[model samples]
Target: MTTSLGPMAPGDIRTRAQIRQEFGGSPQGGICPSDEKKSVNLYSDPSIGEHVGYYDGWLAEEDELGPVFEYTGAGLTGDQTFDGPFGMGNRSILRHAEQGRKLRVFIRAGTIKGTATATHRYVGTFNLDQRLPYVWRKVRGENGEVRSVIVFRLRPDGAFKSSAADTIPAAKKTTVEFVQFQPITASMLNSGPATQGALSLPSQRQGAKSSARKRTTNASTEGVFVVSEAFNTEMSLRAATAASIAVRREAALTKSYRAHLEAAGHTVGAFQIRVEGLSSTLRTDLYDATSHVLYEAKGSSSREDVRMAIGQLLDYSRYVKTDAHPHEPRQAILLPAAPDPDIRVLLERHQIGLVHQLSDGQFTGPDFTAPS
Candidate 1:
């Protein structure tokens, strides 16, 4: 990894927009210098969320290490879970070290007590600490649900720390409301790095061997990569909760389900479809285009989870599209384990299907009658 330049200089502090404008980048695509890779990626945390409230500021404060801040990954609707070295925002920042660049962070420290346009303060440019690099913290999301989010622990490269007077001005409170603001907006998701595509199964399997299992690395056929369900959940939770546990369990269940379907010669993948009233698109967890079956995956088979998945699949089935038709796909819930008999009976009554993982990691079912 390349050596970091150090904490941002006092005079280098600037709003995310100003930094991007001068550096030639967008809120989504990430900022960089005029030269392809010379500039730093600026992360703006306004500390706003519908459920989580103004959390980024507090998380940044808890850090006793000088100039150290826990900057979150991008994704406003859910928890921002890191997807190895392939995710955007936080993961992208790590690349700066390899590419010989820097990551500058800014936090919204509302200058006035009750105002939202409060100018941001420059925290500093930091490098990820190889040890204890990240932690799963509980955070709120737009839906008011709490979930785990990956917060990267970054340390200042050189001797520098923003004074309390500079980091948080006098007369200003430490808390801020979760408000819709610039640099951190809905459109920002659309502006994510072109290289950071959504996770999905490759259209063509490398081999027909049932034992072949690997992470999907190829970009979509159109060269577009949309974020996967796990990462999406991470981004969403990041915006809502303040604490959560390991996210890999949830991701593993989904991957296991997807892999099982593929090995059986059923093409399975996450598909993006437009919802009737929503501006942004909704992605299905596992869409079998050929069979017109849509699956919603849950890490657990508890009643609460099964109920939630049922509702989501029903909602998605109504407005989702396939084969250029607004055909209601056969809806099913995929779980890590089977739910109670009552839950199964309830699902049968509704004609919603149930698929569960067996002890051996194999997926079974869609075992209910399809809704007529």
Candidate 2:
């Protein structure tokens, strides 16, 4: 069977037997660990119909960072653990990420009417989200007892395509707890560092303290300021309905500009601002510490994109703490190309600076060090 199956690509559909023959794992479970290949195959069958307690599918649409597919860990009938003798399925996934094992995923299609075997569509390869690998949520077990489950956040390795039916439904209301997992790095893996600090599961008391500190910090900022890295937006099951191509382009543009700034010996990072009473956070694309400038990047130089950048820069500047810099930081718009003449005039009128990348890849803008 293995000899006849051949190799599987991103969207190939195959039965459990064929997948097992080609890869390695039990024919029955969700997590198939192949020690020989150092890979784990995760099978998600939404047809099981929520008996397992969490939906496993691609986010309805991509988020700011890009498309994310959520997959629940093993042990649906019992409490899921990260490591140890129990929950081998869950542990296999963690080790797959830590040891840099290939993580392949598939979604159940339907059965072949007469036969009992189920077929699955290969989604693509994925990597654990480096920032936050998984979140702990409670779910009802088979016997009606509440049990903890680990929901892993996965990011696609490259282009991924899936049917609309594969979109995850809105998540039910539940208390979600964040667990800190050190991102896997080549240095850490090659050196074989001890696991003590790699995974930190906060104690109940410690969790409470952490929450309290977060609230206090939010209060201190008067509801508007946070270092980008420390801010975690509340989880929303409602996936984006809009196309994500623009968002992806915007992310890429921001990343490239950030690198350009750093290469010129300037310090760069972002800021997360939360308006008072609002559940959402507004994140600035780049903050140049060397020049004390706040920049909002746009993927296109269209009027709409330029307007959005202007508004965002203005709104973000209002809440920046006075002590954050020696003086008030200047505001600017970073665009892929220069805007129209009228748009340039509008920016000048508003005392906003403009920075645009030329075809040759060099950036042109006002001297950031000069007084606004």
Candidate 3:
């Protein structure tokens, strides 16, 4: 049962005007203050003169997020996807959310009536949906530019009583809640690994577009970042597998490769190292103890999957190395299935090695000659 009042419930809901008249606060935007004289911005920012926040909805004509209301932070000034912890508008909402503050929500009431006064509907008090609060969505900025914005999903406080008519409509199913984002903690922001929560593995912003990766994967909160659908059952069956399964597959592939190398009279080894002044440790998937070859593995062979694998392999090769020199290992991308000839060509163009799964359950690759 919902705590919110129905649309026609009398004295159970207030319009934006009522709150303002009773609270006797300023008419400014963003976080508005009421007669109780409490500060109510998404996040507090003394800098950038951001004492208020702009609430917005990016709903398509037929789209909805159940009874939850989603609001975007200010500052769509550029093409970069907004980061939560660093901005005045974005970071403030995150802070308020972490502190368990309920921000009032309002919608422009005169859209259909064309009223002269800026009237709004006092929807209800909403708290950040702590389960999966934020997402990166495309929005048109104040400058008429399209860019990614951090959208905070707010659910009505169970304690706040409202009439049924006032409640937002529920969606048909939870299947469409595809974009689940992890809130960036102060600790995560201070550290520099670009985490795509349920999507690809954590990476640095060197060779790959992290946002693009996130958009392509549409990962769930369960830690499985995969395509929403596959072209065929076999081709797309792995998409339904858990991300943990992918990790295990990578580990199994590494074990098989090590055994194969050992059988071929090549000594295989793994490497790990800690960098100074960084809290995160770096490790290689596999390194040839004898041949100094470094391998990075992907769970699938799609273009995006292979692309991320390339970036990871390169990043690993750059940091992890043998006693001889840095980046000295023959870099190779390991995959569970063969990619297209074009993908192989892309690898060869970069002078990187490619090893893919053979149909009979054995792996074959490094097709290009590794410099002896």
Candidate 4:
């Protein structure tokens, strides 16, 4: 339901030898005749008789030409030589190259756009010491030079401005700031149940620290199974239940389940039934360790009516102390039975997981923490 998007990442420090080798054609900033026999660095002022002219000299062409700011930034196309550091075009540009054994930086970009709109990820350097998505990517030249590019979709302050949608949809929109990352102290692999494909959570940055909302409710049903009202919240959860039941009854067979769930994104609550020899309830109810919808049983044949079975009941879980058994980290038993097929799918779509069974029962099991 909710899509998560963030800002671009920063680049790293590169050596001189790396820049010269990979750099192709003219300079990235359109300054030198990289394609010519004897390329010149036009950034030098002829009058000053030196290299590196007035740092701000290139911005004069904005009135007639734009590369300036349009809506989606679709214009401003010209030869590399036309928009170099000497011209200072409105668009943000950076140059990375090697001169002898040394490296160079061309910081020729504009200020952060006014408001947050879209988000992109860039790889480079960073200083995530803030409350918003902010990181920098070091653009690299052909060989291997570190070209700095400040990566931040939008600082928290950007929310105050009006958006391009208010205008002709042509105004430059900034990206929304989402990740204010703290340094990461752990290096752990992703190990949860696999869907069609495995998931790889973001790696922790060195020394960065941030506490995410850890989802842990391990114990399962341990009382009488109670069937609740029916709900059709999501299709995936329904699909999971149907598939699980089929698997138990030798019906839902598949090497990978993610593909099945993704392909079965047809409706919120759909129940299918078979009579004579086969049966399946194409619905979901139970949730897995990762909050994804677990499989539900297929509805039975004509002779057997579709039944919503209850597993276990817990008079209470709030008073159950997990610390009593220090070794056992995941305390699974909870008062609520696994949600019906509909709710599970909706939660799973959002990266939530569960530890309940589809059918209600007097269930019991050892609670374990989700993999690190």
Candidate 5:
């Protein structure tokens, strides 16, 4: 609300961290700053089964979800409008997430000139993780950089245009535009504004009641605030695969283990096979619409390891708290065996051991009940 953005002031141009702390949150609780966002309960809440890969190890929701906004605090002075190769004007989202200042300021580019080039026929899309009603983010852009960042709160009168389009013609050589677009990490799901976003549910319900019966009933809770299930599926399955290899060479394939994790992940959200939850940097979630079971890699062969992973599974289930999908049965998979210390402990303590820290490859449990 205030201005004079030199470093970052409270209510002026607060970072994601500042907003979180101001309301009600902590730093040490979440898996990481970026991952620890509110809304989705995370690994810490004993009930949530947060895996090692997610922000706080919380499972990714598999159902259809509404828009979830992502505000970046990796401040850049100018506006590539995004965090690029260099960390210029490098503004960290939050310093001490514990202070409860873990909230990203929305972009309010409405006050400034519009750069997006939108025509009647051609319309490019920007990532609308969050559908803010009256907020805009301001950032300075160089040839391809971020600068002079500022945020403003205002109402939009239906005047939004798509920015410049990136045209990549059929390339002669393999060209991969390594744009580091941060996926809603586990931390953000567990601790970031997501939970805070939950408070809006009742109002969301009341508004739904005003609509037609079909629309009102459907609007209450089914798809009001759902995230992309497809994205969650891809990310979470990836986490399970990594854990499968880490706990043991082939723990992921054991029919019993795979079945357990398969059922558990779908219902619970994630497998709590690791203490830090799932691997943030590495993960893949797979979802079967027909079967409706989410599978996770359980590396340890010993019952103790499987039990730990089970406990983590229970954790995620508990936090979902609501019996939103009671019919769904989730699970964790622990099979095979490994020799790494982290892997061993994960198996012994949390039941997450299937993973190859150095590489993105893995094997299923001895039974080879490969994931779907």
Candidate 6:
């Protein structure tokens, strides 16, 4: 007789036995594939001992897009491959997106309130992030040796309820190289071979609009020491998505500050610095022509926000000098409100000024003097 399973919604709790009865899959493994329904169930248990090398949990914080759930592929030691017995779980997840298979996620909760049986909290359906599907990380294996493992990036299809217990503690900051996979189709095979070309650098300054791309040339006949253009590809994508509430607040803060500067009769603009050999470019938030100051704006006054603003101000100061401001522009940070005393001291140590908006809609900061 077919089992009649009630509707399972996001944030609902279900036990392993009930899940197996509703969805036909093994109760042992982390990845359960149901061939009859073409769906996959992903299970993550934080209670599992780390000695077993099971590092599955939600990323510490959400990005501008949304919450990211990281699931480690199956394997105990050595390099994890996608071919043999251990490969079944990893392959099922990797092909889920391309194969149009549905993914239902669950995280292990301690146990039902009054019962000893374990329960899993449903985390809603998710899909592999197209921009970055997976990143390889080195973690200790079951044998006490370090080995590379695949960590898939899964984004929720809709609303996601976050739980502190399911979040992995923030790890030491390390460079993560993301791998992007694109499905090959018949149309792509029939198309001509793709061509590679150098990025064209514009040589003329555009209008005074903040989004306009401009090329700054050295006044000296030094033969164009550096080029500055507007780099907004990533920013444009972020603006289009408008997913993260934090990102929206930051954008609003930036816009308000720009309007304040303009109202005060100050010439303000932004720049994207591009060096000859580098493919990536650095973009500044605001450049004051009247006072010759470079201001990096942040929505919040948190330590992390202040730290990022400090780095951007220092980095952009190097390339912001032009004919109008021959020397490196005085660096400063713009914030919605004053940061902590320690943050103020930190900014002072770096010789960077701080500007914050007051309740009366006025800005207060160090005096900006034209560079001599």
Structural similarity to truth (TM-score) of each candidate: 0.43, 0.48, 0.35, 0.16, 0.24, 0.46
Global lDDT scores for all candidate models: 0.47, 0.61, 0.45, 0.21, 0.26, 0.59
Q: After best superposition, candidate 5 residue 4: deviation in angstroms?
A: 4.1
TM-score of model 6 vs. true structure: 0.46
Better of 3 and 5 by lDDT: 3
Ranking by TM-score: 2, 6, 1, 3, 5, 4
TM-score of 4: 0.16
Error of 2 at 155 (Å): 0.9
* Per-residue C-alpha lDDT of model 4 across residues 300-342, encoded as one tens digit per residue: 4211212222111111212111222212112222212344565
- Per residue, candidate 1 scores C-alpha lDDT tens digits across 1-372 of 111234335334454555555444455432232235355655454445324522332221222232334455555545553353224455455445544555555555444356443444554546554322444444446667655454555556543334332221111111111111111222333444312222211112121212112122322221111224333222221112111221334556776766565556654455544222221224456666446677887767789888878888887676445434346778888788889999999999998888888898776785322222
Judged by whole-model lDDT over C-alpha atoms, candidate 4 comes out at 0.21
Which whole-number lDDT from 0 to 100 does residue 168 have in model 2?
58
Task: Please provide, for model 2 over 1-372, each residue's C-alpha lDDT reduced to its tens digit, 9 standing for 90 to 100.
Answer: 111355776667888888877777787888888877667899998856377656787654344555556788887666566445556677566556445466688888877679987888877777665434555555565467666666777776653445666665543232212222222232322333211122221111211111111111122222222222211121111123232345445555666777677677876666544344222234567777677788888778899888988888778786543344645578889888888999999999999999998888778988775323
Candidate 4: segments with Cα more than 4 A from true spot:
1-26, 29-257, 265-372
Q: Please say which candidate is ahead in lDDT: 1 or 4.
A: 1
User: Could you tally the backbone clashes for each prediction?
Assistant: 33, 0, 16, 72, 122, 0
Off by over 4 Å in 5: 1-10, 13-69, 72-292, 298-308, 315-326, 334-372
**Candidate 2 CA-lDDT value:** 0.61
Worst 10 residues of 1 by lDDT: 173-182
Identify the candidate with maximal TM-score.
Answer: 2
Q: What lDDT does candidate 1 reach at residue 31?
A: 27
What's the lDDT for candidate 6?
A: 0.59
Model 3 over residues 123-201: C-alpha lDDT tens digits?
4455554333454544344445544446566655432332332222222221111122233444433332222222221
The residue ranges of model 2 lying beyond 4 angstroms of the native Cα positions read: 1-6, 141-143, 171-372
